[model samples]
Structure formats: C-alpha cells, structure tokens
Target: MTNRTMTRRDFGSKVITVSAAAAAASLAAPAVLGAAKARVVVIGGGAGGGTVARYVAKGSDDIAVTLINDSPTYSTCFFSNLYLGGFRSFESISHSYDTLAADYGIEVVIDRAAGLDGNGRTVTLANGDTLNYDKAVVAPGIDFKFDAIEGYGPDAVETMPHAWQAGAQAKNLKRQLLDMEDGGTFVICPPPNPFRCPPGPYERISMVAHYFKSYKPHSKIVVLDAKNKFSKQKLFEDGWARHFPDMIEWLPLDITGGVKAVDVASNTIITDDEKFQASVANVVPPQKAGQIAQDAGLADESGWCPIVPETLASLQVPNVHLVGDAIIPGDMPKSGFSANSQAKVCAQAILAELASKQAFKPRFRNTCWSLITTDDSIKVGANYEATEEKIAKIEGFVSQADESDEVRAQTAAEARAWYDAITADIFG
Candidate 1:
C-alpha cells in the first residue's frame, strides 16, 4: 500500500429544495406559540447523524439542535482499511466536532445515548441527564455480534483483533501484522451478507497482502468467508490473480465449510471441515444495530431498524428515524456514502415535518472503492430513487475486469478524491 488519497467521501449531485432558515414561522407545532424552539437531538455522530445535525441546524433558525456521540472525535470507517494497509495515518481518518458545534450551531454532546423514551420524546444519556427532542435521528451504526462467533467475544479482541470497529483495534491489527514472522500465515474470516462494507474483507486481504509482499514475501493469507460469493467477486479474483498469485487463497462458504468456531489462544479458526492456524486472525463477527437502537425498541426481530424510505422515519416508533448500517435500507449497501446521502434526505424530511416546508423527492447514491495493489483500485456504485415501496435502484456501475493500468490509477485517484470530500462533508 502507498501513501494515497483523500477528498469528499461521496459522489453525485444532491438535489435539495429546502426553504430559508426562517421557515419555522409556518411551524404548526406548539413551539410556534411562544414555546422554546423545537429541539432536534441526534445520536451517534457518524456520517449519518453528524450530517443530519448539520443540515437540520443549518436549515432552520427555529430548531435547537444537539448531537450526542460516545466519543469526542469521530474516526471514519471508510478509509480505516487504508490505515491498516499503510496508505494513511490514523490521525488522517479522525475528525473533530468543533465545526459541527461552532459553525453549524449544533450542541455536540460527548456522551453515549443510553436510552430513548420515544413516548416522552426524550433521549437519556449515560451521564444521567435527559434531553427532550421534537425529533430524534438515531445513527448508532453497527455493533458486533460477538456471541455469533464462538470463542471470539469482546474479551478476545485484544488477541484476535477483529478490528471491525476501526479505532484502537485497527491500530492493534496493524501492530500484529508488523510483529509477525516473515512466512507467518494471516487468516481472515468475513461475516455473512448484509454486513457493513460488503467488499471490506477482500480489500483488507489485498492491503495486508501488499504489506506482506513488500516486507515479508513468503507470508501467506487465507480467507474463510461465510458467504458463497461476494461483492465484486470477479474483479477481486482478477486483481488477486494479477497482483498476488499464490500469495492469497479464498474459500467460499460451501467450500470453506462455514466458520464453526475459533481458538483465540492458538490463533486458529475452527471450521466445520478444518481448522486454520495463523499468526494473525481477523475474525469480523456478525453484527447488528448499536445497543441504543435495540434498547430504544426501534429494532425489529432482524436486529436492524426498519425505516420509511422517503422520510427515514422509524416504522416501530414515531418521531424517531434511523440511518447508516442500523437501518434495513432497501437496495443500498451499508457505506459511508449511503449514510451521508440518507442523512440529507432524512434531514429534509424532518425539516418539512417539523416546520411544514415542502420536501423534495428522496434520492440516494453509494460508491465503494477497494485498493488491490499499488495504484490499482476497483469501484462499484449505484444510483437510487425512493418509491412508496422501497428505495429502488435506478442504475449501477462497477470497475471492469480488463482495464488499463492508467485507468486503474485514475480509479484510485477517484477514490482518494471521494475520501477527501466525504470526510470534509461529514466533519466540517
């Protein structure tokens, strides 16, 4: 991996028809009659919640907005893989909430949202304080299903290093790779479909392979996937064959015999058919909506929140909305771009619902980039529109198999540009 790119984390034009910040004059709520301005409380300051807080606050002078996050600073999961692959530093992917608070007039609360009283229209923080809200946007993102993988739970992360959450664990995974012997084997177990970043594990393999090839040539990598096929399957197969033949091996679900369990002490992943020993084991367990979403009673039996496509309003609870990997958004892969896009639409819907402004049609978009080797990247993306039923895919595109080196380099550049732009759009 090389020291590479940065830009906006999203692509395509955003069509917004929002009124001026003074649109709340037409608000039909009790706040319009000499009450405190309507309060909007956003939980989880990621691409989705942060953007919503900014957009809603930026759109209305009559809404007092507050963003609640567990952390003081936000670290993006989008480019954390680049950090693992040695392309970017840890600091590059981390962002602050100063701008979201100071510039957008949003009160950024550095505390976890422990409970939500939808009936009372209030969010209870872990700090024992309750904040009332006219509307609440819940974007707690994905939390790992540690119980899904036997012998690999929260206690085992320090050893096996799932690194899926992309913070200290990412640093831990990187350190493990650096400390391994020259010919040591690294094993990765990807979760089942509908997980965040469908192509993430494969890209991790690519980046890790790049690191091993450059520093430890004889090292080996094995992928024990939970699914039979994966996103960008052919493209990744082609890139692996071209760039690191004999260095990596991928066994699909039927062939890999589905992950049965693991032995964290021995760095071994036990399967239905065999056991894989490795110097490093990256076991990304299955995931579900963050705890707050589940605790708020917003999630269904699927452990994910269901939302109305147009407004992103929760189907389970009124005056509550969901976004990012927490929502079962139709036809949209869980990505930062998708979250950012959904937040924009969600903010508009909230604005309209809160202040009686006309809302625009909801459109969503997502593009995912993976680096195979130095200066070589593959991308897949799609455009979507919201119908009464779901968010339907309008069209899509992916990187071709037999592209030129110049074109691949250009694709890598495009990914870098997206990184720079999306981070700014989400953080600033």
Candidate 2:
C-alpha cells in the first residue's frame, strides 16, 4: 500500500507549512512541551478523533498531529436524533475540520484508511499512500452488519433509512416522515444489546412521536425492540404515555423476534408472531467496529478492538491506541461522550508516552440522554476506572431508573445544556 499518490479529493489541500517563527509563537507554556516533537496520526475525525487531535495539539507543543477522515465535514450522531425528529436542521449537527487544521495546527487529511500496520507504525490510505507515525489513535466508529437481518443491506437502506450514522441518511429519513400521510405507521427496529448509544432508539421514537403530535396526530410509531430492558426505560415509557398517549407502541423481543427480516419495497417487517407493513421503517442493524478497524487486524472475533485500559493502546499492537466505538471498553456504552472522555484520557497517556514518562491513569465517563418527547428527556451516566486489563464501572455511578416528574424535567434541561457543552468541547 506504500507509494500511493493522493488525488485532490482524497487528501484535500496540502499541509500548510508553518515556519519556525510561527510555530514557536503558537507554542504553549514551556512546561507543556516535555519532549521532542513526535508525529501522531489519528484516523477518523469525528467525535473521538477530533477531540484527541485537538487535545494532543493543544496539550503540548511537541506533538504534530494529523487527522484523516473520509469526509471533509462531520455531522454528529449525538444530536442527530433531533434532526430526524424535525426539531433541528442538518446544519446544526454538521461541523467542518478546517478549524482543527488552521486554528489547532492539525494536518487534516480527507482520506479513508485502508489498513494499519501497527508493528511498523504505518497506516495505508485508500489512495495507497502510507502514513508513518510515532503513535496512532483510531476511532473509526461503528459499522452495520447488514447480514444480521434477512433481506436488509446497504441497498435496503435507500428506501428504509436507518439514519444511524446521520448525514444523508438522516435527511432521507426526515423526508420520508414528511411524505407520510395521516394515520400512517412508522416502524422503528432497534438493534440488539451492546450497540452505540443505549438510549438512542428510545430517544428517536420520542422525537418522531413529537412530530406526529402536531402534524400527523393519527400517525403511530411501532418500536420493535430486541432487548427486554433499556436505558431509562421507565422514564421514557412514562413520558410517552404522558405526552403522546397511545401514539407510541413497543414490541419486545419475545413477540417480534427483534425484526428478523424486512421487505423494503413492500414496507413489510417479518416478526416472530406476524408480519407488519408500514409507511416508513427505520431499521438500526446490529453493529461492530467500523470495517477499517476489522480490516486493519485490530478487531477480534467479538467484532471489537481490545486495548490496554490505562493507555487505550491496542493490546495486540504497541504504540497504536483504539478509542470510541471501535474499542470495547467493558461496561461502557458506545456514545460520543464516552469517546470524548476516552480521548482526553488517551491524550494524557500519549503525552506521557511521548515524554518517555509513566503512563497516566485513565478515568472514563459517559452520559447518554434520550428525549422522551420535546419537553421530556431521560438520562443514564457513569464514570469508570481502568485496571491493567479492563475498564470497569466505578461504584455509585449510574443513571436513575425510576420515573419522576422532577427528574424528567431536570434531564430534559440538562440534555440541551450537555449538547451545547460537548459540541463546544469538540468544535469551539
């Protein structure tokens, strides 16, 4: 994969060379740079990748960071549910990497990573160019297992949008909602356990129901859930009855077979007991680490990359760290907040490693919010501690499982505030 040339579309603009004077002027305090400059290659410039690049570049002057992603702009999946529910526009979730390159001095490359040779510390891009690095951080996010369900693949998504990754799919789903007539059925199939954002499916249903209340009051949402219990279930259930009474219906795994098959053209979903046809269907398939991670030999048979808890460095490969949805941090939900928290810990560890210092102890946190309706939200949050082999949940840190009017109101307010704060941490 070496010696590959990059086209204009592949690499975007060439690196903006900064003179020694400019570089020196931009340097942080003397204490920040504890070692000689080292090149850090970060693959995937989304929530995790972008945060790591910024932190590494801003945490010390001695690190030259480069972020490689397939897209020039990233639209977050965190707040994307709101977009699908028609509460926010697509522009609100979309973000550019220009600021990361120019303001933070990160070399941004809009190229897909084809493979990683961790032993050699080199990453091969889709265009065949190979990037050598002192250390590499990978946060390639989630990939759908289309085959997990019968008659469903990338092609099926065109008619029935999952909108799981946001961007175009989000728009597609939104358009479908608008096209639906009154009294139409909107089917939502949430995947099995251990997927990105445990509370996301419930939140999505809430948002969609919110739209129905005003525009299509007779319309209903049928949730075909693969799990018996979900994050903040009681809160979401209560909010649904309170706000959109009878508009939202949930079919647990016992009755639905968790949506085993789908006929997109016919809008038919085959369940255990019977088949269902809907005007619109959103099928969130089972997921693993992104294909790039699996292709790079980072993923094990479990479809996730495992890492040393303290540094997030791959246990299979030295000097290469895996973060975000790609890595299986035990007991942690794959959410943007988890990725951001892990990125900060990863940055600290990388800085220590660059200076030939002891690894920094890593602590991770995640707070996931679900909108039960426009005015009501439920939340689940946790903090974690890293051991030598695995990351475990810290005692006494968990989301409220019970339902209360006061708690729901507080969560709704905090959800909006958290979105603003987290986005600022990544883009601002």
What residue pairs are clashing in model 1? Answer: 6-420, 7-419, 7-420, 7-421, 8-418, 8-420, 8-421, 8-422, 9-421, 9-422
The CA lDDT at 361 in model 2 is 62
TM-score of each: 0.93, 0.89
Q: Candidate 2, TM-score vs. the true structure?
A: 0.89
* Model 1, runs deviating above 4 Å: 1-27
lDDT of 1 by residue, 148-249 (tens): 878987898998988877788899999999999999999999999779999999999999999998999999999999999999999998999988889998
Compared with the true structure, all predictions reach lDDT values of: 0.85, 0.81
What would the per-residue lDDT of candidate 2 be over residues 69-137, giving only the tens digit for each residue?
A: 888889999988888777778998898877777788888878888888876667888877877676899
For this target, which candidate reaches the highest TM-score against the unseen true structure?
Answer: 1
